[model samples]
Target: MRNLVRYCLILSVFIMFSCGENTDKKSGENTVEEVQTETEIQKSEKNVILFFGNSLTAGMGLETSEAFPALIQNRLDSLNYNYEVINAGLSGETTASGKNRINWVLNQDVDVFVLELGANDGLRGIPLEETRKNLQDIINSVKEKNPDTKIVLAGMQIPPNMGEAYTTEFKNIFPELAEKNNIALIPFLLEGVAGDPKLNQQDGIHPTAEGYEIVADNVWSVLGDVVEKE
Candidate 1:
């Protein structure tokens, strides 16, 4: 019986050691995965051209790679721009919301900060002054983070149903902000694509894949002019 007791005691210690070894193995595997993730992030680091906007920037109802931002990346690749394009668009985002989150988004170095917001704000019939303030704040934050960063303001327009007075005021916000901030402006984001049913999706809001390509075209025209690097 005493011999049997000693064997069981030894077995328990072996089992405990085996469990400890498995635990350490799992910890080592996790450490390897963590290092791999960090390596991937480091490899992807490059000069950033950030697209900060709402659904249009988010590429709602379309594949992410087909979105305008990715298309911009493709253009950069062809031109050998050697920049990383980050799409920070979110659906239904208002200027106020964007203002709140701009600093966190600006955590990394951004070469170009393309601002595409205020459409949903206008749609909600929010006061023009408020929208202007929020947008200005966002621009200020970006400028503060990267003093040398180029700022591009993408103008947006809401339908005239909001009243001719409000529509005109909303339309005026972009140019006014652009002039105030001395930033490049795209006059209108949906310039050639707005009224064209063929280009817009069924909702008459977001663009189709082909339409997004045109959007990419509009952005590239302005972006190509402002981007300094090859």
Candidate 2:
């Protein structure tokens, strides 16, 4: 009877161990499934933003990944926002060139567009009307392709040396286009960095690394509102 009782106790211990093992296996599977589900949600929520502009947007003096777009991506990551930024900036590209390439660039999955052209055009003394039309067409095309995508027009200001009339028209183009399209507008892309030697490169046209920070701030101020709405 003593031996039989001992045998029964041993069997009970074996059964409890088996039950615990099964429970642990089930819990492990559940944990894996939960992790996979969360990963899928993150992948699906990723937002794609495109930056279309000239050398300024291309990060002429800095590395591609260190540009303002990349900085903005970092900022978004720090804030826990799911986003992917594409830099479509072409060095020396004018408004006309941007217009020509806008269609090709829009072929990608774009959730938001940061239009920062016209600086080259302004420097080249391109007709303000033509620049405006090109920008207008680009915005319209993007809207047509992706009606839900948001457009953020980055305004530019020609140097005072460009003459009052030309500068006035160049600066006004962004606001007019944004207002007409009912899109977000960044009044000035350079803001605190423009004309500041410390922020600009030696050429006095492109921005330095510090200048990119100011540019990011200028963009963020307006983009924050749009992000909040989203």
Candidate 3:
């Protein structure tokens, strides 16, 4: 009887330990699953800020991370802003071409839309009215997709090589669109960096990585207001 009792006690202890180990393994798996779910929820909660433009927006000669949009993303993260920056800028993209592709970019929801085309149009001496119309249509498309999406027009300028008359009119296009659409405007996207040989690449058009930093600042000046409201 004593030997039988001892064997029973040992078996009881072994069973308890086995059950405890199984419980701990199940608890650990649950914890891992919970963590993954929480991470996915956080990513889904972030609003998107889409930067739509041309070579300047694309960081032509620099790494994608060196672009102004990526810099803006860093700033947003530092400030604890819940926004995802989407760099939709394409090199050599003109306003007309941008209009065609704007719908595709709008496939996902966008809380903020920063329009940065027209520079290529100006350089190519494309008609100012055509440029203005294409931009307006692009803006309209965004609105139709999501009327609440905030629009920020990035104003651009070209040299007098296009003629003083054309240059003056080209500069006017941005403000006019902004006022007409009641959207925010970045007076000059290249404000401090434009025409500064040191800021530009060998092409004297696209900005270098350092120049994109200043560009990011210029963008945030106007973009900050829109982001804060969100």
User: How high is the CA lDDT of each candidate model?
Assistant: 0.92, 0.89, 0.95
Q: Per-residue lDDT tens digits of candidate 1, residues 1-230?
A: 99999999999999999999999999999999999999888657767899999999999999999889999999988987768899999999999999989988988888899999999998899999999999999999988887899999998988998899999999999999999999999988887898789999899999999999899998988999888642
The regions of model 3 sitting more than 4 angstroms off are 1-30
Output the TM-score of candidate 3: 0.87
**Per-residue lDDT over 12-83 for candidate 2, one digit per residue giving the tens place of the 0 to 100 score:** 999999999999999999999999999988876788888899898899988987789889989988998878
Which candidate wins on lDDT? Answer: 3
Per residue, candidate 3 scores C-alpha lDDT tens digits across 1-230 of 99999999999999999999999999999999999999999998899999999988888989999999999999999999999999998999999999999989999999999999999999999998999999999999999999999999999989899889999999999999999999999999998888899999988988888899999999999999999999
Give the TM-score of each candidate. Answer: 0.81, 0.81, 0.87
Q: Is candidate 2 or candidate 3 better by TM-score?
A: 3
**Per-residue lDDT of 108 in model 1:** 80
| Candidate 2 or 1, higher lDDT | 1
Give the Å error, residue 24, model 2.
Answer: 22
Model 2: CA > 4 A from native: 1-45
Candidate 2, residue 11: Cα displacement in angstroms equals 40
**lDDT of candidate 1 at residue 226, scale 0 to 100:** 86
- Which has the higher lDDT value, candidate number 1 or candidate number 3? 3
State residue 131's C-alpha deviation in candidate 2, in Å. 0.3
